[model samples]
Target: MKTLLIVDDEPRTRQGVKKTLEAWSAGRLRIETAASGVEALEWMEENPTHLIITDVRMPELGGLQMLERMSQAPTKPVVIVISGHAEFEYAHKALQLGVVEYLLKPLDKTKLIHSVEKALELEEDRLRIGRMEKLLDPKLLEAGQVEAKYGQHVRDAIAYIEGHLQDPIGMKQVADHLHMNASYFSVLFKEQTGMTFSDYLTRKRLQRAKELLAQTRMPIWEVAEKIGYQTAKYFIKVFKDSESVSPTQYRQQVSDPEETIK
Candidate 1:
């Protein structure tokens, strides 16, 4: 079971959220509430919370301030901000801080439950990926035995590809960087990663583009530019082919206020 920490100043709001989530979750969740940001921070320090749903306006430390404080912790908790109509700026700032979700006041039960579900899904995905990367690290280190002569070059090339996935990445550029022929480098990369370099790069770009579309109100063209697509039309074609939906529709589906985060 995942633990959730709810932070809000109002007694009725806290009770309402707790009741709603408890009913919606059907007893699958464990929830704790704090009356203010200060209390929330204290609770976090003493307990482990996978997700936090906080009100943006509080008496002492506000939701954003609590988030900033959490940034310094060893394991930062994911946050979702609850804001009223007057605090739109604070909500936007929370989004910029990579908040998992933002809810308006007079919270809809379905939307709140969906946001919680989505946050948990994202958190689980992150943990699973972390575990996979850890397991891969040992195998990557062992690869040094077979490719001892070219190990460093291979590592550098992989690093470069990861760092520059949003840019135009070509076999020629990687080959030139490693002082090898394009054909030779292509074969080497495929042998190492079990996937073609072009395929790997495309997957990385699409992953990033999906994140941007899901989390922001950025236009489709802007998302394409951010993910290294020089033409929006081409980007749309590729995204649709890969995802079975156009970028706009993908965003709409994933960004639904009432949808779960999975």
Candidate 2:
């Protein structure tokens, strides 16, 4: 399900928009509303919202200021800025901040709906690219780069596997990439590496998952998606089976190692 946020200083505008969107896209979207930028940031820290449709003028931290802080976050939500002010300066700044759309107040329901749909689509694409790009992130696999222990072919296979842990990869895919018969490649791989290809792949994915869980504030579903798990429930089961702890528990432990020990 897609998640969206609406931020406005006025309670009426915020709740009115939220109800309207809920009525329109109740099942497809999870809509949240905030009355200030501070509340929005707080919500964002704890929740993984997809799109933020915000009012430009707020009591304390304005929408642009909120977005500026959000830009420094690990994951940024797609944004559509709405304002009652018709000034070009506000629109210019909102666009400069990478807003998907900037519309004057009394937002047209039609335009707002279109902008919301567009932002949601963009967020899906953005997350896919982000996950794919993290496939070969050296930081995630820095400690696992011990290919010298294997033969050249096995080493190459290992590299390929690491770079595609987020993909639907199996021994056959690696074998095909190496231009070798799948059965023969499997035999050679285990002979040289001391571990079966499937085991090795799962180990690496779990290793990557651990790194992300420990080092980043990504949501559990995003972490699972990034490491090739197709669903959050499956990811949670696998992680618990492997580590004897749920992903969230592991993150909490690592986040405060001293407290965990105590």
What C-alpha lDDT values do all the predictions have?
Answer: 0.78, 0.81
- The TM-score between candidate 1 and the true structure equals 0.54
Q: List the residue pairs that clash in candidate 2.
A: 83-105
Colliding pairs, model 1:
118-261
- The per-prediction tally of clashing pairs is 1, 1
Candidate 2 lDDT tens digits, 1-262: 6678899999888988898888879678888899999999898777777789998889889999999988766567789998888999988888888898887878788887888878878876776555444334353244256556667788789889878989888898899999999999999987776678887788789888988987799999999999888998999998899778999988876665232111
Off by over 4 Å in 1: 86-88, 138-262
After superposition on all C-alphas, the RMSD of every candidate to the true structure, in Å, is 15.4, 10.9
Q: Which candidate is the best by lDDT?
A: 2
Model 1: per-residue lDDT, tens digit, 170-258?
Answer: 87998899899899888888887666778766766777787788668888888888878899999999989977889888777665422
